[model samples]
Target: MPTKPTREQWLRHVLSSATLTDAIKVTATELFLEMRANLHVSVPRALLARRLGRSERQVSRRIQVLKESGFLDVIETGWKGRTAVYVGMFKSRGSDAQRVTVSSTLCEAPKRHPLEKPVPVVAGHRVTPWASRHITIGHLRHGVCRNVSTDADASMLEHVPSLDGHAWRSRTAARLTFSARSAWPLLRDTHARLAAHLHLRLRPVAAHHSTAARKRTTP
Candidate 1:
């Protein structure tokens, strides 16, 4: 008889696929790992949701996604007074055929458009900073400052708190992508919130030279 794939082996294939996010991949792998050798998983959605810090509805959606992806099969649905039963169908590893299949599937995964493009902008809309083609790290950093300037200079007070800059930018971009219809409004709210408590100037005094710069006037 063929040996069943280990939980780690299954996880490698799941992660390599772009059909699910990291969180869903981890949750689905854990569910299978906790199952018995028979591949029967009798876990409650509420319990899984609590463990994953997600809503029960969200957990259910994730399970449905897994089912559609052919990784899981719902043996029995959990309804009143019963827990759901699922069977993991992930195949055994340690074979050339398995490796080739996984590689081919991964290569066929849909390619996501680069985030630098104006994908969040709806059609027939005038371009603004929020709808601009490229939102760079410097754009978000400038949003934290109240003053406007021609060059990339710190002409105003540093209003944002000291935090990981890259993470903040990523979060902003994600939020923007999900609300394409209200991208401008969402960006305005985010900028306002991130720029709150505008009393700090933590940089060195030399860094504040731009603050002293005056607008050039015609002679």
Candidate 2:
């Protein structure tokens, strides 16, 4: 018979695979691991909040984050006075047919990540944050950019499976605020600023260089 994964193994998988960076996520995952192997656990929000030293709302948000990131599954939702049931899950698959389905969010993640790499402009709109801010400022000055609430924080890219080819991004919400006259100049300035910022940030410092040199020069 196949044995269930130990807590340590499950935690290692979570850390390595999800690259989980938040304390809440870590704590929530730990709680999930304390449950039965089959993940037939019923944890209440208030109880979880108390255990983690967080507000119920915070715990709720953390649970949502876990679900969205493919760390937890909702086996059943609470209705009336019932508590919800959840199953602990990770991004791995077993050879057997009774494995948890991989999350679509993770599958779509790499292809559509907002900051995967620097994108200057897409569909005549500034994609970089600095450039987008500059465009917003320009519009603010002219009172032209309305519907500010509808602004998009990320670019939606077309999914292309080929490695040799590149994918095109859709027209971002920033384009909605743009006029033909100000569009080109705004994009140009934003791209220039972003490039300079990247250059400075990515430039090797003396300490890093010295460390590398020491490693190479050491006997």
Best by lDDT: 1
Worst 10 residues of 2 by lDDT: 161-170
Put down candidate 2 lDDT per residue, 87-139, tens digits, no spaces: 76766544222322223323345655468667776476544433334344334
Candidate 1 TM-score versus the reference: 0.38
**Which candidate should be chosen as best, given TM-score against the real structure?**
1
What candidate 2 gets wrong by more than 4 Å, as runs, is 1-3, 92-219
Native-to-model Cα distance after best TM-score fit, residue 71 in candidate 2, in Å: 1.4
Per-residue lDDT tens digits for candidate 1, residues 1-219, read 998766555557767665566767867776866777676778887888888888887777777766656677888877878998887766323322322232344336787877786657565523234343333335455555333432333343344443443455456546545656646665666555544422132233324544555323323
Residue pairs clashing in model 2 are none
CA shift at 61, candidate 2, in angstroms?
0.9
| Poorly placed runs, candidate 1 (over 4 Å) | 91-219
Which whole-number lDDT from 0 to 100 does residue 78 have in model 1? Answer: 78
